[model samples]
Target: MLTRAQVDENDTVLITGASGGAESAAIQLAKARGARVLAVAGESKHESELDAGAQEVPIRGCPLQDQLGDNGVDVVIDLAGGPNWPELLNV
Candidate 1:
């Protein structure tokens, strides 16, 4: 999907649950392809995601909607999908 979407150095990618298998791979691949990778994962998994080449968007004590402002991310790779599904649709 990343390739189909033409994700490149100019893109900002948001990968949720990035510590998991699929998301983790997506993060690494997207980064390798030159996109700016922003990841959302458990507080404990932040370091791992960083190691995989993504910037963490702390989701623990912080409000997610606030962290993600009006201008949304260019691409979203969601592995742990939930209510955030609808939110992503809106974005």
Candidate 2:
């Protein structure tokens, strides 16, 4: 997934469903590659995501676009593709 996204140094990568097993590994990989990792998960899993190497975790109940602001992430790994999938593109 990182290869397909062309993740690189200084890039900002966002991972949805970030508490999953694969997503946890993805966070570490993104960080190891020198990219900043932003995780999207429930509040309960925020700490775990951080422990997995994510630099930031969006607050639950807030829109992703609002939290990300104008300068959004360079890559998005959407592990939880569902009703909110379309919203990811906006961010």
Candidate 3:
């Protein structure tokens, strides 16, 4: 995500699919850098923030898209930027 998003202190990263290891690590580092980390994932994966140090935002259906609006995200760490990504991007 840094390669593209260029994460900064004021950036807020909304990490979809928070259960992955690499993305989880990235969220942790982003938060440590003083960025607000909103870890979005399925209800079952909400407990992961204990180690990632991110504020868990459970998406019963589509939480990231729900939180995101017309403007672009400061940084989006999409674990699976496949077909479902458009839903979040449209936000």
Candidate 4:
């Protein structure tokens, strides 16, 4: 969708719920592909959620919303899929 949406390489991407499951998979995949991915969540410290030397782990918590104005993410992948979903949009 990013390619079709015309998102560029410098664009920041916000991915919610980074602590587990499929969302974690997507985080790793997106980072591997070279996107600057921000893993948004209340907390993230699971076993595989972050590898030993992952370049940048997503910035966690609602406080990160402050970045909305300037850090401005280009795309958002809300994997939490519910109430947490709105944080990505409303932020």
Which one wins on lDDT? 2
Q: Which pairs clash in model 3? A: none
Tens-place lDDT per residue, model 4, 1-91, is 5555455556666676777677777676666566776666444463345552233444565455665556667777777777656566664
Cα RMSD for predicted model 2: 1.2
lDDT of 3 by residue, 1-91 (tens): 5646667787877777777888788787887777777776767777775467776464737644555544345776777566667666664
Show where candidate 1 strays beyond 4 Å: 60-62
Task: Write down the TM-score of every candidate.
Answer: 0.84, 0.91, 0.74, 0.64
Q: Give me the overall lDDT of model 2.
A: 0.87
Candidate 1 vs candidate 4: the TM-score winner is 1
Give the distance in Å from residue 68's predicted Cα in candidate 1 to where it truly belongs.
2.7
Off by over 4 Å in 3: 68-72
CA lDDT scores, all candidates in order: 0.78, 0.87, 0.68, 0.61
Model 1 over residues 1-91: C-alpha lDDT tens digits? 8988899999888887777788888998998889988888777887888888886555643555677776577888777777677665554
Best by TM-score: 2
What is candidate 1's CA lDDT for residue 27? 90
